[model samples]
Target: MSQTIAVLDFGSQYTQVIARRIRECNIYSRIFPYSVTAAELRKANVSGIILSGGPSSVLTKGSPRPDKKIFQLGVPVLGICYGLQLMGKLLGGDVAKSDRREYGRGRLTIKKKGRLLKGLPKSIKVWNSHGDKVTALPEGFEPIAGTENSDYAVIEDATRNFYGLQFHPEVVHSERGDDIIKNFLVGVCKCKQDWKMSNYVDQAIQDIRDQVGDSRVILGLSGGVDSSVAAALIHRAIGDQLTCVFVDNGLLRLRERDRVEQVFRDHFHVDLRVAKSGKRFLKALKGVTDPERKRKIIGKIFVDVFEDTVKKIGDVDFLAQGTLYPDVIESVAIDGNPAALIKSHHNVGGLPKRMKLKLLEPFRELFKDEVRALGKELGLPDEMIWRHPFPGPGLGVRVMGEIKKSYLDTLREADAILLEEMKRTGYYSKVWQAFCVFLPVQTVGVMGDERTYDYVIALRVVESVDAMTADWAHIPHDILQIISNRIINEVKGVNRVVLDISSKPPSTIEWE
Candidate 1:
């Protein structure tokens, strides 16, 4: 943690990806607003600065721009996309809208093996998503690489240790992206690779102890990686001072309550209280069909029920959640830029309002994979650590249209079958999320010579590094056939099963 790389966010969706890439190199990194001053960065003791790409055009007036003094900070500065254009504009160079905008894959031909492009090939594939390009290089700047459309795709001022790229190297679609980032971190910035998950664990435990001195903490343990790890870490820091509440909301998957009870209560010996409030949640959710309405209803009811349970459990000082960085970034607009709010996280800002308790979120700065690693480091079993992410609204969102007792039962059974077959076929751990979305529409089918109309289940299985982007997982036809057959026959769900073959852009992983 001694040497840090600071990423300046300009409302880019891939801003977190840049931070994640730096962390993957065992170098600590943090994100700041585009308005962060050089004095602030100097106080942060940043070894290098990375300007993130955004959906902004540098040619537009009032577009997002960083403090001009950052160029004088003397740290190695790497600008990307809009960042690159911003640099060219601010540093006495010309930036204009490209006649041929590069939005997808492009080839970068290295003109010089500068320190920023050290060890890279003469030509490499890159992922581009920019409309503006640097037309003229600033003083003391030279082009190190060029794409077919962008003559100054990569520009560098070696004297000032400033570099720019018109393409994003943090995305996986870019070949050798990690190497380019590594070159910047180790080759140019000279960052010490000393950060580790073990260091984070030790630091987090001590931080929890410091933050909650002699105060009892209450955690809503959903048995997911984030909460589970938070519980384990907090419990390790202050034994018996943590009380975990697992609410059976009638919308969870098959036997989720039992699994949670066994793992936390029986195995881990956590102070877990199960509030058998399934009927209450179901009643509140009855006749609700809109996804947003379902989420809000469930969140409000959960907070109400959770607060009631807390009243019975005695006085609590703090409320803990397993909120990760994506949730934080998505909820809050980056410096009031045009990132736009995606959705409010149920575990983030909801409970704190009604409960009126101090919030404790240890994983707020962490990513999903980082939380899983922390869970594993904290001695959580592989099954729980690698569990596919479940929506905060639980199966409430998964059961698409209305909330009904019979629909819940049917969806739960069908989802369980899908998971069972996935595990059997070794596809469970292979995908990021695998679930069944219960479609309210019924279809005609012939079952045992009887014409019947029943519910249809849409199977969504996606592969993703981060939930920001995902592609449908390509399970073999044979395995899919087995899953479809099992769900149709073993589970009493109505007739048909369909696979979602769409990617993330046009279609989301969830139907609703």
Candidate 2:
């Protein structure tokens, strides 16, 4: 078994990404809050501890602080960003408000050679996002690295197995960041990288068996990869004790409903209950024009429909969902209150409160790509494993204005053609997410000297590590032209096509 590391989150937006990096090193990891007790940490048998950066400044009154007993655990501890400042303040150091706040990329120079900086270059570019800087070093800790603005950049307390870095190494902009984390896990903590997808599958099977025993579990399959993999894992664990309930909200793509039922029933040999609630969902979303309201309505209806299905299928003790790490991080509020909901994350926020079933989220710590890797490890089909992420509300939110079957069908056909052409050109695997959004506006266009007015379709493709920030994928002009021509000629009701060039901060992935 691989050694387990516990990452204590301070409500940072990048907490999940930090855990993902550790898993990428082939090591098992879990995330907890700063308020987690030392006894709880001991129960996990954590070989090492990591403190995640938070959005709050350490000098503030209401800022989160870790359990002081964590340092007494006598295990290796690494802190990043705000975590570094917290360690400094708790251990006889000074952290003052910075006159110059660093929000993006910067260079750091390593002054001393230590185990953490062993394989890294002398000067490395790193991602920094912090308002305060460590002005003084804690006692028994030496500064290993520093930037021109901050002298106490990287501090290490070898005696206590404590390390802290001012820069965020979990992000990709910090190129050698993974190596730095590996040096701490392997060299400093001496942990073996034995964790893999197969190990996760075996452990998850056992975990499910132990938790459920003979109890029944009802999982909601969304036809997306996450829920599909979750259902398969649960079925493998307890066999007939698992029953899958799939709800068709009428917002899915063309033939998605049939494909979902066929894949689960025929290929996986799992018990599936298909509920067609298209009319109910469309009825609830009749005249709702607000984007957030549309999402909430769809989410509420999904829960109600799911609960009704569960009642019909005997008694179920658990509800299994495919809630990934990004979902959690994005939904987490910066205020450090677990009860405080951010956006209505249909899986994490909406269902748990309304339904009485116990939650079972196996992929809570895994990122989107990591979940796909686990899906492949379990022998899932390529189409299911590599499918682009569709939101819980589906294209209902993407339509922008009203709910209509005709418009949705047209959008789905255009999207299918776009994906097919991208796959043929070998660009499907390269982009993070690519899809078609049906615009509420229409324009006049000529198809052989005949003027016609039809709906305009917008294409969006973005590349991002986490959904927090993204850049528009630079698709080839030839490919874009082909996609545009095909949508205009093949898919009816769409006269003009346009590509979205906006990034994430200024624009969301979906038009809504």
- TM-score (C-alpha) between model 2 and the true structure: 0.94
- For residue 378, what is the lDDT in candidate 2? 81
Per-residue C-alpha lDDT of model 2 across residues 41-97, encoded as one tens digit per residue? 987888999998877899999788888888888789999998899999988889999
lDDT of each: 0.87, 0.85
Each prediction's RMSD to truth: 2.7, 2.3
Q: Over the stretch 147-220, how does candidate 1's per-residue lDDT look in tens digits?
A: 99989999999999999999999999898889999999999999988898898888788889999999989998
Q: Best candidate per lDDT, number?
A: 1
Note the residue pairs that clash in candidate 2: none
TM-score of each: 0.90, 0.94
Query: What lDDT is obtained when candidate 2 is compared to the true structure?
Result: 0.85
